[model samples]
Each structure stands twice: as C-alpha cells, then as structure tokens.
Target chain A: MKLRVRHVSRYVFDAPVKRLAQSHRLWPAETQGQSVIQWSVETENAVTGSGFRDGAGDWTQTVTVKGPVSEFTVTAEGLVETSDTSGVLRGHRERVPASAYLTGTRITGLTAELRMAAEAALEGMDAASPLDRAHALARYVSDHVVFAPNRTEPATTAAEALEGGEGVCQDHTHVLIALAHAADIPARYVTGYMLSTEDSQGAEASHAWAELHVHGLGWVGFDAANRCCPNEYYIRLGSGYDASDAAPIRGIVDGATQETLDVSVAVTDSARQSQSQRQQ
Target chain B: MAQADQNFFNEMLNGTDVRAAYENLDRWQANMPSDLRSLKQHEAEQLFRRVGITFAVYGEGGDPERLIPFDMFPRVFTADEWRKLERGIKQRAAALNAFLADVYDGREIIRAGKIPEHIVTRNEAFEKAMVGIRPPMNIWSHIVGIDLVRTGRDQFYVLEDNCRTPSGVSYMLQNREIMMRMFPQLFVENRIAPVDGYASALWRTLASVAPKKCEGEPNIVILTPGQFNSAYYEHSFLADLMGVELVEGQDLFVEGDFCWMKTTEGPQKVDVIYRRIDDAFLDPLCFRPDSMLGIPGLMNVYRSGGVTICSAPGAGVADDKAIYTFVPEMVRFYLGEAPILENVPTYQCAKTDDCKYVLENLEELVVKEVHGSGGYGMLVGPKADKAMIELFRDKIRARPQNYIAQPTLALSTVPTFVEEGIAPRHVDLRPYCLVGEKIELVPGGLTRVALNEGSLVVNSSQGGGVKDTWVLAE
Candidate 1:
C-alpha cells in the first residue's frame, strides 16, 4: 500500500526543558513479511538525528530544543510493498518450533514472551501466510483485552495486561506481540502518533502499535488499538522490544526545576483526495 | 615552596604559551622527576581514543563522545605513596568489614554508644532484612573501593567509602592497558606495577566467600540489575574478565534456601554472586516489594548460608556519608592505631551544634546527602549562588539527619591533555581493595579527573573524565 504520513507533537512545560533530546524507532523495521519500497522523513526547524544507540539496541538521535516550548514534527511519505508466505518450518523456524510456546509456558523477559506467544498463536497456522496469522493474532488480542488508558507503564508486558484485562494501546500491542511470537512470528513494539478522524485537519495524540515479521513478507504493521492495520494516519517515531525503549523524549536535566510536561500531537490524512477519488 | 619540582613550575610560568610549555620536549622532560617518564602528549591521546575506554555521561544529551572525557597524561604514584595508600586502604577496609559484621550480628558499637542507634535505625539504606544475618566467612564487605585524594605533598585524605558495588574497576584496567601502549618506554623505565591482575584477584575474593557446600568448584556468577543500570558496563566487563556468567535478576531463583541461575543448559547452582544490583533491588521478598529486578527469595538463601553475596547486603552502613565522619574514629577504636590517611573535616548535620553552624555557614560548607552518590544531592557552597545555598539550607534544615556537611578541599591537580593543550586538572583516586581470606589492594586504582577547570567533583555522570593511575615501583 502507498501512504503519506504527517506526525506532529508539541510539548509545553511549566518550566523550560533544556538540552531536549529525542530518539525515534517508529520507522517500520525491515524484515521478512513487510517491506518499504520508498520512504523519506522530512523535518522543519528541528534537527533530525540518527546513528546513536540506546539501551534497547535501536538507532536513535538527540533532537535539541529551540526553547522550553518545543515541538517535534515528522512527515513520512512512502509506498509500503508487503508480501507473505509459509511452508515447512525451516532453519531458525525449526529452533523456534510452533510447539515451543506450549512447552515453554513460563515467559520471563519481554523478548521471551514474544517468542512464546508467537509460537502459541502459530501452532495451527501452518497453512496460512505469515501476514494472515499476524492479522488473526492482532484481531484476537483486540477482542480479548479491553483498552484502558493510563493503566500501565511503557515497560508493561503482554502477559501482565492479558492477566489484568486492562491496558492502553501499549498493552494491546504487547499482548498481540506475545501472541504473534507464539504463532512463530517475530514482532516488535512501535511508538508513533495517530491521526484522529475528527481532527482530519490535524493530528490527534501520541500512539503505539506493533509490527510482526513474516518469513518472506518482511515486517507488517498492525494496530491492535484500532484493531486494524496501519494506513496513512500513522507517523513512525521508533520501534523497540517494548514501549519504554522508544519513548519520544527522555533525558536528564540539572538546575533542580520541578518538571511538568503537556504533550499535544496532530496528524492529518494527506491521501484524502485518493480515497475520495476511489469512492467516486 | 622550595621544592625541586618548583623549578618546572617557574619554567612554565616564564614560557610565552602554557600549551607549548607542556608539549616542549625539554620542559615536559624537566617537569617529570628524573625517575618519572611518559609518552609525548599526542601519542597518549590517540591510544585512549582507539581503546574505546569510554563512559556514558548521563545528561550530556546527544554526542556519545561527550560521555566520558579521556586525558593523555596518566597520574603517577610513587612506590612510597602507593605503599602508604595500600596500607591505609587495607586498614580502612578491614575496619569497615569488622563494623558491618558487628552491625548485622552483635551491634557492639551501638551497644557501646560509639554510633548512635537513631542514626543507624533511621538510615534509608539500613535494611531490617539484613538484621541477624551473618554471611559465610563472617565478612560483609568482600570488595571495597576507597576514594582517596592527595591535595598536597604525600598528604592523602579518604574522600568516601564505596562499599556498594563500586564501579570503575573495568575503566581502571582498560586505562592502564592504553597507558602502557601510549607510554611503553616510560612504563618500562618507571617499572609501574601492573594492575591487570585485578580480575583474578576479584575472582578469588568472590570464590573465597562461596557457599560451604560447593567448596571444590563453586559456581560464581555476576548478577546485574539489567542493562538500564548506569553501571551496566562495569558489571559486564568484570563478568567477562573473570570468565563468569553474568545473569540478570530474572535469571536467578531461590528453591528451598538455595539460589540457582537459569542457564540455557539447565538450572545451575549459583554458590557465589558478585551482585551489582543495589540492596533495595536484590530481593522483592526482603526489600522493595515492587522491584522486578530482584529474585523473590534470594536473600533467604544468602541468609541461610547457601549463597554468598560479595560486598554483602547492608554493608552500606559504613558507606553512609554521615557515617563517613566516624571512619577514622572506627579505625582508631577497632585497630587501636591512628589512621594512616586523614579524613576531610566533616560536620554531622544531625547534631545540634553542627546543624546550627551549617545553617549559619550554608554558603561556605558543602552539604551532601548521607546516602547519595554520583554527585547527586550535593551543593558546592563556594560555587553555589545565594538561591542554591538557600535551597540547600532548607533541605538540610528539613532533614538534618539525612545530610552532612564538609569543608571543600582543593582536590589535587595533574597535568591533563585538553583540546587547547595540557593543563592541570583536579583528580581523585579510587583503589579497589579485595578482602576475602586476605586483603589485596590493586596496585593502581581508577583515577577520576574533573574535566571542568577548578571543579572538585569527579563523577562520570558529571563531566569528569578518567586517567590511568600508575603505581610506580620507584
């Protein structure tokens, strides 16, 4: 699918936050089930950074601020070319068998849960394509867990939310990630901004979703929050093992000022003409 | 001062350019005592950059290179100075070990009223979970890094005691390797004692405290709180160097008063753990209940003598910045000898008189949190403006017992290579001392350099850099 993305986030503070640095991992990871044919990110008045690695092994950049009242705007226009396939569990697939999730029941770390969940979800999914299983798993998670805002931290796990039955988009994505891993799919957490239909003229708020890697199709995007796949409204910030690893902005400051931050984001449907033309 | 080294200072003052004076062949040679030698300034800088001996400065925002500043010149310690420092470090470590053993077991010092009970009871780091628990070998602090600063000629002072998973040993080892390559000729000529054996010494220290049941070949692992910890590099480096497994908290579990690590092969018994996690995060069952970085009942195994944790839990009792005021006193009381190293004049804010004095002289004294490290909870009175001083005064007044005040000593300086040229920068040393079955101080400790001019703070989180410390045989 070809799509144009517009993401904007503004952070207003009670006091100015100097040395403002941010890292974005939202660019869909290049893998098997998903592929990006052409993508370019443009920034205005803000320094676009790259080539720095944080704790989670993702490339990041430190975006300095003009002042305390700062805004980060990212616009990506791209054609996402995706394909999916499935056959015998070969090579690495053999190691992470479809039965591994059933046998390894106890999932400890963030990555381990994804592995187990993918295996479990993929248990009977031998006949389907990698994207077919991923889509199924994403829908299943949305049906199972109800989305509740401000209920979990960025590091909250899929199992924790599934057991608790409450979480935001972060938890939904993690639960889906776990289920995808159980189905033998490699998935990652993505942080970005969601464009609101009501605010078609602008973006809505910061958002989170998940991407699953199929054997041949590369990495395919799934929004467990909206229970649909990503289209033109999603603006990629960064992706990681979990949400905490890809927070839009995080850094330390001196001079002992109590920090209160307010974030406002906006994304608009840049492909409105194309969709209207198809309707006509 | 009529010292022979004074002439070098005069010659530098006479030079048109201070940068040229440090780099000039004749002046640089003359600055070093005939006995001391090192590489040319440029060569040393190249070696440091190549070795990847760097620290991640916490708040410097963007550039990775801005994290840990590196200098060209290595700090030199004469054989005589090293001997004195080694003895002082060993003595202080021994006294501290004894103090920890007593605090957790007998509370002899408390009984004698040497240290106030309220102070001990009110400490944030003082864990009730550690009470009545005696580790194997009865040693609490198996490893300690005693920070020392030499302000004047051979006058060494104990800055602070780092008994809690003290980092920078990896940097110490890495720095020395770089120093050797940069100043190969100087190293051979000076015959500096190699500190490369620290890993082996550390391994032995941890092994000696291994659980009794697994005597012949005990399984020792280095437990880290995970990669988010600021000291994660040190934890991994030490583990790799010691050839031991580095396990995260989740990788460990307690089964019937025994700790075991979950390895890929199977559940391997962990007899000894060089734990880098803080005491509060060591066990969810015993410490912070919400901490996922800790095993639920790992402390139960340690208390039951089924496992040994190096620099045992609650060893922070002696490391408390308030308690630091009494270290020299503890040394005198326990060892029955005067301290080899002097302590900075410290004032306990909890005391009525000292609090009054600190409140009166808030702008002249450096106030620090009793439990804080990494240059946090510190107010440099001299450098601080009136508002900062007022803010710190209020903090101290609100919680007198949690703070301590000290006279800011002019930390000694060493010639360091900077972008402009070589200039004198304040630096401090932290020598690692191992006390297992025996006490062994690594020949050279990590020399932390304050990169900013006239700055006394040398924490990596701040803009401080590091230099290889050479303990010369001469």
Candidate 2:
C-alpha cells in the first residue's frame, strides 16, 4: 500500500511569544515494514537545523522561529510505500541495545495489577516462546482496556488505565508495554500514522502502537486497539520509552503568554485516490 | 586532624627519621610556639572568610556558611613520587576517555566479554541519545578528577573517578594562596611547583574542544546552576579566573542552529559550554520535561554540532562505582598498557559469593551505594555502630545490586597543626586531569583531611578540612 500523509500542527498565542523551538522526529522510519518515497517537513519562516540520525535510527532535527511572533504552523508532508511483514520490523538500523528498552518509563511502568494480568495471560503456556507470550499480552490488553477517547489523561500510567477499563490507543500501548516488561520482554512505544477504514482511506490518522523485542524475531508490532498486528497500512515514525519521548513534534514557546494548539492529520491510500481521479 | 592510628603509615616520618620532602617542614613546625600557631590559624580563618571560600558544611549541623577549617601544616610530596603519580593519573584519564568513546559507539570491550553486557547497557548513566553523536576531538570527559588514597610509602590506590564536573579544584588553589599570604618565608625556603597554570590549561582545554563550527578563538562560558548551589563559588571563581562568562540556564537561548548568550553588549555565540549542570537538567526538550534549570532547545544545538558541552552529558557512565572495577581492563584493552595504579579490591554484592562474603564480614568492610556520592548513604564498617551495620546488612540482602563493599585500608596520614601541636590525620588526593587536544596534569591537587580521630571518610560535607598540597620542584 502506498500512503500519502499530511500532518499539520498550528499554534496560536494570545500575545507575541519571544521565540519558538521545536525538536522534530517527524520523518518516516527506515525499515522493512515501510519505505519512504518522498517526504519533507516544513514550517513557514522557521530555520530547520541539520538533521542527524539518532541511536534509535530516527532522523531528528531542530526547528527554530525567532519571535515577537504570534503563531506558526509545522507541517509534515510525506508519501510512504509500506508492506506487511507479519509485524516483524527488519532492516531497522539502531545502536541502542535491546536491554535499553527493558527499563520502564513514568507512564509505562509495570504495577502489581499489570504483573497479575501478565501472569494470567500466559498461565498454562510455560514453554511458550517469547513471541507467543507477547501476542497473548497484547490480546489481554485488548480485552481489558476498552478503547474510549478522553477517558484517560496524558499522564495516565498503564496500571491506572487498566484499572479504569477505558482509554485510547496510547493507554492500550502503555498497558501492553507494561505487560511485556512484566513477562521479561523488551518493548517500546511507537508513534506513527495508520490509514484506517479501507474504502475511505483518507481519515484522521495520527496513531500509536507498541513493539515487543522477541528473543529471535526482533521487534514485532502489536496494536491492541486494532486487535491485530500492524500491517501494510501502518507507517512507523519513531519510538521511545513512552508517548512523550516518542512525540513527533516536541516544542516550547518562550513567553508569559498563553498558547493554543490545533492539529490535523490525514492519511490517504494513493492508489485509490488515483483510480477515483481517473474514473471522475 | 585525627590522632593517628599506630597501624596507619605517616608520610612525614620513616622510623623517626623525617622524610626528605618533610625535612624543611619539620623545622618550621618545631619552631612555631603554640600561641603563635593558633594566631596563624585564626589569621588563616580570616583570610578564607575574606576570600568568600566558605562552605555550608552539608549535614554537619552548623551555620548556613561555615569555613572548611584550613590546616596550617602543608602536605608535601617529593619530585619522584609526583612524577609517578602524574604518569598513572594521565594514563587512567586517557583510558577512561577511550572507554567512554567506545561505549557510546562500538562497545568493543563488552563484545570481547571483558565487561558484562548488562553493566554498560543497563546503566542509568548510559544514555542512548549520546550514541553516534561525536563531540569535538571525540572526547567525552574533558576534565577528569580521580580520587586516590595512600596506604604506605609506595602503595596508592584509586578510590574512585569523578568524570563529571568535580568540585574542590578551587580549594586546592585557595589553600596555596592563603598559605603563601601567611608564610611567605616557608615558600622561599622550599621550591614548590606552581599550580596557577591550571586555570590557563583548563581554558585551553575548553577552547581546543570547541565545535567544528567555531572559528578564530572559540568563545567559552561556564554554565552554572546559580547562586544557591553549593558549588556556585567554584563556578564563578573558575569563570573569573579563566576570563569567561558565568551564565545561568536562562542567560542563554537557542536560535536557529546556535546557542547565544544574552550579554550586555548583545547576543554572543557560545562555541563551548563548560556546564556545571547535571545531564538531566541540561536540556528540557531532551531529558526531563519539568526541568526549569535547562534551556528548552540547548541539546538540539549540542546535538547538531552548533556547540560543545564539556564533560559531555553521558560521561558519568564511565565514573560509576560498578564500572570502576573494569577500568584496568579498559586500560589494557584500549591503551595496550598495564595499569600503573591499583584499584582497591572491591566485592560486588550482586554476586552471590561476594554478597555472602560482604555479609559475613560486615564489621571489617566499608559498604557503599553504587550510585551514592558526597559521603552520604555509606556505612563505614569500622566506625559504624552495631545498629547501622545491621540496617545496611538487611538493605543489602533486599537489593544486593545497589551495594558494593571493600575492605578498609589503613590510609596514610599527614601531620596537621592541632590544639596539642602537630598530629596525624588521614588524607586523600584528587587531581584534576584536563583532556582535550592535549592532556595536562598539574603537579598539585586538593588534599582533604578527616578532622575527627580514627575516621576514614574525608568528605568536606562530612566536616573534613583541607590543606595545601605541595609537590616539590626538582
């Protein structure tokens, strides 16, 4: 599947801000699961610093807008060709040891409840492989954490989300990551774009998922919200310990003034769009 | 200074015959009357106060600002001993930098099975963000402070290494300044190597590691945590000495690809930042989200090669206590040289055999937290009461990986002017080795002394004092 993605984030300040600086991890990842055909990240009147690939195999750069400015918009426009690798992430270049991801972050820590759930998920599968255990944990999270938007806050932990029984994709990802940790599997939070709903491929598509580092299979994607592993429709961006670290555009405005944000992300299947255009 | 234990070796004496380095010092000590010595001590205190080198004496239960008692008697070292020490310290500093460079990039040592995989990768100080981002000259720790303790005339063991921004270099300079002011004739009589070159060497080191984007003379600034910090005096003093800007987190801002300091003249581009701030508080956008002490986009500038951070962010990984054991191996593997200095035999409590040994011999060993510093959260087995030892034992049993134990060495003592004339006190050395395009080691270093009788710990925060450490010029 060839996916065309456009993500725009606009900021409006009540008063002029002194400056705005943002670190962006907005480029599509280089992996066997997806390959970028074309991509460019831009903001009007902002100087983009030289981009460098990080330890996690993500190319990141800094964008600065010298201020006395009222507003600005950061837009990420890209086209990616993705394939179904049965959720296995191959050809991803990274220097960070798999053990680095074993440590839990503030929002993805394993709790007593998470531990109990993890144990229950693989009760009789004592001899099961790490990949199988990871799958079971994702299934368990899908069953327990109901996908409900606005049910949990940004700072909500996996344990808190699990007990509350209502959360978004982020909560589900965090819960699954916590379970994977309890089962002694390395896992990370993945941020990306997902083209959902086949017939109408163009939809609001900013999404998140979890990747478990199995013993032999390396990193395998597991999306508890979708109740399935990531497929050709998924375009992975970057990964981190949790949601905040993996945020595509982390920005700060220097001023005492209050600011507001407006974001829109649309991902469309290119083949369907071209066919519809030909038919019209 | 403490009353010397019979078992502890006294550096000034060799069976009643004064050591060659102390021959002149012995005459000076014997001639001074008790009243005059106290008067000179009083005068020294006034001198220290006037210079504003006073410390808060953390956990020592004193006034907010109190003097770190200055001993009138100076610690002396011969030219031969200092030469050997300089070589050892320089070798260790080079090896440490090599280890850091390798750990962040190839990690050859771990793959060789010399150091366990988990030890480097699992360390909290080991940062993934630093990987593949090479700083200027491929150096991580520009300034290395290695702590050394002596047990006998020829036996010196490294207690630990401080690869991060280590304090107490100011104390070394101040002690010499005050000593010279009080007793000018003593200095005239003995030829001592000058340590004033340290400031210039440090300045050169900082300049040499300037980012590739820097042209002409690189602009340098010392990034301090601000006035309330314990080492604020040292920061300002270093900046003043080196003739550079002393800046707080808010004093600088990132614009475009560079970091600029807001000066009275206007914005100035900073090529090198000798930051005294910790890694977690250096940049808010990169690490901790709630850190107000960090500039929001400073790390972005650092990462993009717009500026350089001295003793780079993840340099602390090489200085960790657990990592200290493998430094000898690093020296052999990287430098292809044998270790000149010895490491204190340490037992990792995480290993079952070591843990059992440490637990069985809790009375004779000193147990310390792996990440703990500043003389806090440590059990001085010999000095500790029965209750504290039991508490540590239980804590170690609960989490063995958090602790490391070493048998207490009878550290060497130097004669210090006490209420009842000169007495022996345990002392340690911390020499600041500067590495950049060139590695420079000043002859003299900070020598801390334990003020209480029979105490082994010599941390200033624990009521220890300092003395002028003199290395004789040949």
Docking class of 1: incorrect
lDDT of model 1, residue B127: 54
- Report RMSD (Å) for each prediction in the order shown: 22.3, 3.7
Interface RMSD of 2: 1.3
- Which digits, one per residue and each the tens of the lDDT, describe model 2 over residues B1-474? 233456888999876777889999989989888788888999999988888887543223455377888887999989999999999999999999999999888889989999997788778898878987788999999999999999988899998999999888898899999999999999999999999999999999999999989889999999998887877788899999999999998999887778999989999999999999999998878898877787877887888899999989999999987799999999999999999988999999999999999999999998989889866889989888999999999999999999999988998999987778788889999999999999999999999899887777787767588999999999
How does each model score on lDDT? 0.65, 0.87
The DockQ value obtained for model 2 is 0.65
Task: Give the CA lDDT, 0 to 100, for residue B292 in model 1.
Answer: 73
lDDT of 2 by residue, A1-280 (tens): 8999888888899999988888899998778889999999878999777778888999888888888889999889889999999899999999887888887888988788889999999899889888888889999988998887677988999999999998888898999989988988889999988877643221323689999999998999998988888899889999998998888888887888888887787777998853211100
Residue-level error in angstroms, candidate 2, position B376: 10
The native-contact fraction of candidate 2 is 0.64
Give me the displacement of residue A194 in model 2, in angstroms.
Answer: 0.5
TM-score of each: 0.54, 0.93
Q: Which has the greatest TM-score?
A: 2
